[model samples]
Target: MAFNPPPKMTAMAAAAGTYKANLSALQLLMRGLYGGAYIAIGAALCTVCSTGVAAHLGPGIGKLIGGAVFPVGLIAIVITGVELFTGDCMLVPLAAMMKKINFGMVLKNWICVYIGNLIGSIWYAYLMAVGPLVSGHADGMLAVNAFGITAINIAVAKTLTYKAVGAAGMWSCFMKAIGCNFLVNIAILLAICADNVVGKFFGIWFPIMAFVSSGFEHCVANMYFLPAGIFLNHWHPETTARIGGLLQHFGGLTWGDMWLWNELPATIGNIFGGFFFIGAMYYFFYRKEVPKG
Candidate 1:
């Protein structure tokens, strides 16, 4: 069959979640580390491909280009069966709601995967900063390239911009994250609905593209994006000067700002969006329709 009905898809999701919940701690962490690195690869590709694109092709086209290429990571994860924290934000909760997994199991999976993702993302960020972002330049020895500047700009925008608006900026990040994971979990569901590899690829691709192009915030992707910026800024003070104005208000990017301003709020919002909006809602809508044995 090419596609499963909603009830079947929900059942499949529950079964998959149960399987995920049963994985040992080490398994979850190892799978999740790969998941984080995969998503970072897509994020880095988006940054490099979209650099200065807006200047020549317009902002909308730039977003479209980035969105088009960004799904490779998620597609790879879905196909390879790596554990991604954002997708788990929906799946594990759905399993708990269906009584296939307990809430404690859910929490355990989340904590392990989240930590693994963080470690993987930061590790990739360091590699990217020292490698492609500067093209093998020694730290503080060479001028930052356009890609490096873009990385710093992304970091500053995601963090300090929100800090400037105080509460409202945080709220904006929260809402964007909600939108992000809603589409992400939808992509997960769509992948579940498909029986073939090609069907799964398109299923995951569209929603992810929509989320990226629409300017939604994704916590896992930001795990790579924000830290890459911070690493760049630390190594190249000259790049900070290039960014100018916002520097004074935020006092430059720090690890503190990255978590407090963007990652924390985005994580909370992703949980709400994935767990409640997509997971619970779908379960309720399809529960009675699921075939009983």
Candidate 2:
């Protein structure tokens, strides 16, 4: 027979329950990091498809390619499971701010996941741009893709990159990108928070659709796809130098000009856009009724 415990033993049980709650919070944070990695992988593949499709369809359809392919990645996230930083950008930050999770745990999850997503994106970009597989598409994929995309496409990419970065050539364009990201984040978070699967799908798919169609900035996805284009371009040293020189001569661009000038500010803009538009707003508007931790 088991011995009966004293009153102090009941206190120990409460302490153990508290410990378990904290542990569960930690687990949720890790889930975010894992999600980030998978999302990056999906974006990398999407970029490969988009880049190839854009090459064939022409730059005019690049926006269309973005609209179609990103939803596929989001499906991969919702149904099949992929790490998605954008979704977590809404979820994890909200959890952290609400003190539903410890700060160290939240930061750990975000940093690890962000780094993993970056690595996955770079790896995929390299494979898509330089790897033989990308060049192996049907109907002489290699020859046309190379010939059509080379030289001419760089200018289009650079222009898009500028709007993406934040040096929007005009404030109106920058605000547009910011607004695009805001709705995208709101949609993603709402989809994830929705009770039903269909609700989730529409929430994610439609907003992503809007952003892509509108040519908005998605810093995480861009973080993966853009570098791949640059890496593949860098494969031909002479072309790289000529391209670099041409950008300098005409566009007044340099090494830092590409990423720092465009990617960094865009990245900052994305964070603000997501936080204010999605996470904070939802917390204030929707979550006010939810019990406080």
Worst 10 residues of 1 by lDDT: 135-144
Give residue 91's lDDT in candidate 1 (0 to 100): 90
Give TM per candidate.
Answer: 0.97, 0.67
- Looking at model 1, the pairs that clash are none
- Relative to the true structure, candidate 2 reaches a TM of 0.67
lDDT of 2 by residue, 1-293 (tens): 22213222222222322332344444544543445445545554444455555657886586676576667666656665444555555555666555566657545544555565566655655555565323455655342244224422442354444544454443443455477668766665555455567777776777877776676666566655456545544453334444454433344324354465445655556666765666676566545355322
RMSD of each: 1.6, 9.8
lDDT tens per residue, model 1, 1-293: 58999999998898888999999999999999999999999999999899999999999999999999999999999999998998998898888888878999999999989988888888888888988888544553655678988888888889999998999999999999999999999999999999999999999999999999999999999999999999888877766667887865556789999999999999999999899999999999998887664
lDDT of each: 0.90, 0.52
